[model samples]
Target: MFLRRLLPLSRRLFSSNSSNDPASIIAELNKEMESVFGEPPSSTHPNSIDNNVMAAQDSQSVSPKIVENDYGLTHVGSKGEAQMVDVSPKENTKRVAVATCKVILGRKVFDLVSANQMAKGNVLSVAKIAGINGAKQTSNLIPLCHNIKLTHVRVDLSLNRNDCSVEIEGEAASTGKTGVEMEAMTAVSVAGLTVYDMCKAASKDIQITDVRLEHKSGGKSGDWSREE
Candidate 1:
């Protein structure tokens, strides 16, 4: 039981293959002695069995690197088809995702929306509603997306007059097998598009950019957040 408790720690401190090699195991023990006593082992040392045990302990301390391969489909097949991820056997779990998008419009268009002078009427409110609707319908728009029930969806919009841009944020939550990252991203994208549709009459220079997932939680790999 004590050996089991110390095994993981030992593996982290020595070379990766030291545990399998007798000579390397002995060297590891000698190195630990040098560290603890600040001196080399004596040539006349008579306790061979103790020395071997110490060597094994030292060998167990080496650290190993974890390597993972990219599983995403990056190339089209011979028949011009894309590969989809297989999640058939994965257990269902709760998941949430958040994403953001920015729409940069001309100063005139921004001012028109801000002042409620656009002929379309209530650009921000319409976009927010569209975003929520989009979140609910994301699986329909994107192929291979699992159609799971969304427990909640929220969309927030902010105006940056100084930069003539509208920032859109979307959040989606679900209790199912897959994550909602794509849904959140799709919400922001559709919302930005709606803004462009409503305000296009005011200015034709609107540009939607930076549609991306901000954070996600729950799943086998655990949680993740994109760096700012």
Candidate 2:
């Protein structure tokens, strides 16, 4: 009876040590993986574990592709089918996005906006308000967008006397699951529209151009910046 109890205790101690051992744990994990996958994992490169993990993540992640639309809006689609990205499993991170738009107004409209002679109000102030509001309402305005919390939205308008144009720049920041790229773009678009509305009496030939993402930071894919 005494020997039997000691045998059991010795076996228990050996089992616990084996289970806690790194080599034994690795072997057990390999067996488990083989049982599930029906094959042993290849050991191609030891340092490629992170790369493999990233590749697996990329395979499971939702990415966007460009497609043409009737309203001249470029959208993300796959195999001729429009799809919204699912960001459910992504981590929340601090993100900042910036966009710019240029409205090429003729001399008359440019002068009116620059001189603050518009009948409605100050063109820059009204446009700034509109841009901020548009940034907040980005998800509501754009279809299939996820509502996200925004931290800040800023709009800046500048007049180029030599080119006879007005440039609108928008920046949006957030700490959330998704980026504020759409918000920045929407702000720039709305600001340009507001400018056009304020100066339409002077000229109707204003052209909005280059509404695009300038820079973005944070998220899994890392930072991006447009080339000047």
Who wins the lDDT comparison? Answer: 2
CA displacement after TM-score superposition, residue 221 of candidate 2 (Å): 1.0
TM-score, structure 2 vs. true? 0.65
lDDT of 1 at 75: 38
Residue-level lDDT for 69 in candidate 2:
40
Residue pairs with backbone atoms closer than 3 Å in model 2 (clashes): none
lDDT of 2 by residue, 1-228 (tens): 545654555465457754477676557655555555678547787669889999988866744342234343324454555667778899989999999999899888878878888898898899999999999999999987778889999999999988899899999999988889999999999999998898887788989898999999989868999997
Minimum summed lDDT over a 10-residue window in model 1 is located at 63-72
- Quantify all predictions' global Cα lDDT against the true fold: 0.84, 0.84
TM-scores for every candidate against the unseen true structure: 0.65, 0.65
